[model samples]
Target: MPATENVHVWGDARPLYTYTRYIQNHFGERVQKLAVDAGLSCPHRTQGRLAGGCTYCNNNAFNPSYCTPSKTIRQQLQEGITFHANRYRRANRYLAYFQAYTNTYAGVDKLRALFEEALQCDGVSGIIIATRPDCLPESVVNYLSELAQRTYLFVELGAESSHDITLERIRRGHNARSTEEAVHVLRSAGIPLGLHLIWGLPDETPEMMLQTLHWAAGLDIQTLKFHQLQILRGADLAEAWQHTPEAFQLFGLDDYLEFLVPIVEHLRPDVAIERICAEAPPKYLLAPNWGLIRNDEILRRFEKMLLARNTWQGRCWRGEF
Candidate 1:
């Protein structure tokens, strides 16, 4: 198919449902997303569940330098707009990404204040609040649902994995049940839902990870991001892996691409794939250096592979769960 032609199921030229294409199709314009650190701490980290955070967590691995919790929301958004200005010149509109820590862990009133502050920022058309499933109380969901009616809003929940054993191994402090309940509540309230999942975790086999894709295919999620776990410096998982190296099997670049191809094939056609891989700066990364490859390059290669094999998302999908 030509670039001008749209794939019927995906509604785009891409082999898979892409977030960029989805945004373009919906907004009819380029929409840039800016990450903001709202200074909110996770209950699992601050409330005595985990001393540091999830075993594999190192916020420095992904957080932008411009995004610091110490900065006020207005200052952060200004810096973010400036930072992304040169890169995304075509994007006049932006979505404030409440990315660092659990964004919805606070009380509903406080959460509203923070969200409203971001929404009020110049050029910001919507807000994407990244949070844990266990943190979305009924009140928060109700409030967010009401807010969604007024502006573009999204709630991104970190599911990490669909398996309880993997959740326990990562010290996630929540189970798949909590994720399901949260998804149910958000979907019931007509909120757009996004989920994040990590493919490589300690003791998680390829089969186990694919099973997670099968599990997520049944949900009301509109978007999904698949991150291959990157062991970062100063993270608990790094120390543990060093001590018991055999306990985990890390994926090299090719290995990960080959491993992920089938999983994508098994995914539902409607779930937009926001990110197929996660990249960290070389300074913070500890293993599996795939070079400083940009996401576009990786995605181009991924789609080429799919085309070469004559396969696409949902090619192997089965509704039976």
Candidate 2:
């Protein structure tokens, strides 16, 4: 009678492969991700693919002050561990997250050195490499497969939007085909895959946003994360919104909740949702002000909304529907 019966990892409340439960199930204890900047630069920024990186990007908006590339990997990991220990006391283990720019755009030898360094750090159980879809050359994919056998590793690709038009407008510099190819290559290499997508980009309607989930549900990826577009200071997106304003439709907290609830039903149950919302520092944020609510509070609100409607994840999954 209870939906939790059908779920193994995080129970009915989560409705998807929660990062917390997944780490616990695999490691026998909770593990937190310590994001490290690794001082990596993207081809888009340096090689003139687009010029100024993704239109929505400003690495400082998300990176903690301690996560500077100037510091050695060992130093960054030690500081991140301390920060998390004070904030999330439940986690005794960590996954070194290479989150800045295109982590894999560099040569395979450089990537290997950086990743191996993280793996050797204290309390780090594994590593998560966040990269662009266009950067995963065959050599990198092959190397990642080898690394997976030696240590726990996951590669997260930024597939941002499913629509090529939207990707172009946002200066993603890579198309949907490249994303699909990256997934196929990673799947073949036997590497665990994760995807990062953004909702509410300019010109994307609510219907179009839901379609991204439909697109993702068909993928073989093991984890997924979603964030609403945040027009942070110094971003080209913010400048564009400031000039046109009418061209974009940013979602306020309540509007986003209404939009997100039904979208969850359409996701593949096996795909874990890492995050549904993200917060930027108040000084940098420009619009759709949601006040100072933390991620946990927002998640709590989402759970309450689901129960009130009696809906669940994968309710409208392809075969089930």
Please write out the lDDT profile of model 1 over residues 1-321, one tens digit for every residue: 222344637676567888987788778888999999998978888988767769998887789989998998889989988888767674789999999889999999899999999988888899999999999888888899999999999989999999999999899999999999999999899899899999888888888998888888888899998888888988898898778877778888788889988988888877889999998888888876788887789889989998888778777876642
TM-score of predicted model 1?
0.95
Q: Highest lDDT: which candidate?
A: 1
TM-score of each: 0.95, 0.95
C-alpha lDDT values of all predictions = 0.87, 0.84
- Candidate 2: 10-residue stretch with minimal lDDT: 1-10
lDDT of 2 by residue, 1-321 (tens): 225555532453554456666676678877888899998878888987678989999888889878998899999999998887787684767899999888998789999999989988988889999999899888888899999998898999999989999999999999988989999999888888889999899899998888887887788888888988999998988889899988788998888988988788787766777888888888888876889899889978987887688776677776431
Q: Which stretches of candidate 2 lie over 4 Å from their true place?
A: 1-13
